[model samples]
Target: MLLLRQRGSLSASQLADELEVSTRTILRDIEALSAAGVPVYVNRGRNGGFSLLPGFRAELMGLNQEEALALLTAGSIGGRQVFGLGSALSSAMRKVVDAIPAGHQAAATDAAQRILFEPQADLLSRYRLAEGISETVMNEVRRSVLDGRKLRIHYAAEGRDAAWRHVDPIGLVTVRERSYLLALVDGHDRTYRLSRVLAAEALAAPAERPSEVNLAQLWEARSARFRAGEVQFIVAARLDPARREELAETALAIVHETAESDGWLRMELTFQDLRHAAWAIWKLGVDAEALSPPELRDVLHQHAVEIAARYSPRGPTLATDA
Candidate 1:
């Protein structure tokens, strides 16, 4: 309809043919348009079909109820963070909504009211340093990947007291709610958590990005294969049937349940890490068991040892080697 208006005027049959719809549909569309305050005009006799009054804005004739409502919702979310752009987005949303048919306004408003988005705590908190560094590195890395350029970064590893090597940033990934930078260090692709990073600077000199190793493909493959030492440790656990169903919905572990035997259901799971798994098992207390990857069993044992040491007759104290 707006496009037809831009062309000055067209008959109902002409609009139906242009829009690839029936003539009745075009008449109904014109009626809806006019009812929405659009200056649509019709002329009778040999040469007249429909036309917009002179000086009428064409953009005002384009939006439908659904599109207007979606824009309004997006504008609200955007305005909460980037103030300047948010205001402009909100203004554009208003104009589009106002252009929609008045009869559809209530429906659009209702739809907008139903939409909701929950922002993450980490994102809401102004972690300026982490955000700024992550943004710069990601943008530069993406540009470098496209342009086939190399990057130098200063990073720190978890459990290490000092910052290590100037690495070539290859790709980035997010696993278990944390972000990591995947890079090539000494000819091998290594993953480094962004939270552990201290500082990163791109060397003026650029190295050629390798064609054989596509960062995105490599990340997907590694993620699928469940690569070792990738910030998460896999721990196997056996859970009772009742508990298995509760854990099935979580990404933290993959659970497999067995048939109930003697009124107790048996199941197994692969945990993302030991610390939380141990704590959870302690809560389940008697129903869960840390099955494999000796380290996980060791973690459970250590917890017990700590508890024993805390309440021992001599009071909490570490046993010293003779």
Candidate 2:
């Protein structure tokens, strides 16, 4: 019946044929819908078999109040980060709940009493401009990817002046709660974080879709290699057993822990740079040492020398030495 109403209206014979039921069955179904306050009407002869009264819409049949609230809460959260959707989403949800048949209202209210949503602290304080820009760029990128269009973007890179370039928008990705646009630039595809993009505009000419190269697979391989580059040296450490657990949680390096006698721990990890690794080890205060990668050990040694030089007694005055 809902499907028939969605199509505007249907004759009883047509409804029966579509539903694979007898005409009498269709009549009974329509009667049941009317009883449930569906506002169904039947017209005889040359015109209509049945039709929903003008402006009538199907109401929620089985959802309880709690379920309705849960759906609304989720929609609200999504609306906060999405561009221009908050109030409409809230209004639409209310309309849906209000349209529920009278019989189900009590059940919905009961369910609502049992359900709750606690908003996160940062949910209401999200950066609106950034969110709006991200949403716009993402929507445009998706459209471009689907239509095989080229995009001209003003991109900003760390330590370099911002520049504009034309690219074939191939994909969009979300990583660590941030969005990025993946594009084919100068014969290679690379990801540009949307936050770093100063501006983006679509081009008039569409680019040809590449021949069967999987964008997602290429992205994963490239991203992994990029992360791996952050580790420049492998530094081995001997840690006190009690302190070993604390050191293991560090993300600046990858740590390998080994059992050692006398309550000591032997571990090895990769560090991006000697100075950074040295400072981190120093912060551990006493239980850690840079055992391998002589360059990193030298860095620690140099730091110690510098600290000692600062505190050492000044050379005897010339007159005193004489």
Candidate 3:
């Protein structure tokens, strides 16, 4: 309907191609619009197309108090920066507040203010390394995804040199602070970190993608496959509450945690492998103790013995050791 109103006329195939849907779907949408009393009509010729009646304008729907408050609180969640729509979100939020009944507006505003959402980090003071995304590069990638066009990108993957590649972008996903571009490279599934995109170009050619895509499902499937390939090493350990932040930062996953009578946290944690487990537990020093996996305990015991031997006053001097 917006397309017809703006362009005056566009063929069914043209609308389908522009919107990335089937012509049958476009026809159904047209029918729905007509049934909804939109002033839409079809031209009957080879060059003919659909058009809206002259001077027709869609009415803006008003929101109730609860809906306005929900939008207000949600808009404050810091996600609008994903596509650079922060200003637009702010404007929309203002409109929502103003559109609501004046008597309810102040109450809604107060309620929204009291309902606080947790930020990206928890209260443990764990450090998180955020991926840096360039605005110019992001804009280009976003364009490719929205326009359904092929994208040429200069990307630097982990442990690899930056290089150019062409991909058909399916969608962009933002998980917490990091963003990913789900695309196809050489007709195979590939996911690229948006921060790793040094530069990008939106090509005129349309992207080769499925007509319908479930980005969430696709991301989950890829994540599951990736996790399945990693080594799972679980370590049972007791940690001090004061050092919880340090443990959370280093461990791959914390399986379970229980508070002991001695005020220490007994935890079953996961690491990439035995080496990772050893390094993490050792870094915690006396604040943590590894209970299970005798191998880990043995490694720590040997490390402590070596340290004791090095500092022992009665031990051999450097000259004697050499």
* Candidate with best lDDT: 3
> How does candidate 3 score on lDDT?
0.84
Kindly list the per-residue Cα lDDT of model 1 for residues 1-322, writing each as its tens digit: 5545346669988877765679999889999988999888888789888988876654457668768887767765522323113334544655666577767867887787788654343556843232323545545555544454566555666566746465565656654445667776667766776656555555555554466666678877767666333437555566666676565544344645556555554555555666756666666666777677787788788888998888977524535524
lDDT for predicted candidate 2 compared with the true structure: 0.68
Using lDDT as the yardstick, the better of models 1 and 3 is 3
Q: Clashes in model 3: which pairs?
A: none
TM-score, candidate number 3? 0.60
TM-score of each: 0.49, 0.49, 0.60
- For model 2, state the Cα shift of residue 19 in Å: 39
| TM-score of predicted structure 2 | 0.49
What lDDT is obtained when candidate 1 is compared to the true structure?
0.62
Model 2, span 1-322: residue lDDT tens:
4555446679888877766679999888888888888888767678766877776655445565556667655654423443234445655655546555656655664565565443443557754333335556655655676677898888887668999978887766654445677777877857787777777777779764575667679778867776586567677888887776566655354557777877787878765566667777777866888788887778788878898899888776844774
True-structure RMSD for candidate 3: 14.2
Over all chains combined, what TM-score does candidate 1 have? 0.49
lDDT, model 3, position 298:
95
lDDT of 3 by residue, 1-322 (tens): 6556546899999999876689999999999999999989989998999999987754546678889888989977856677655656765776666566657868988888888774656789764556778878888998999999999999999889999999999998887678999999878999999989899999999999887999889999987665556647889999999999899888867778999999999999888888889999998899999998999999999999998888877635655874
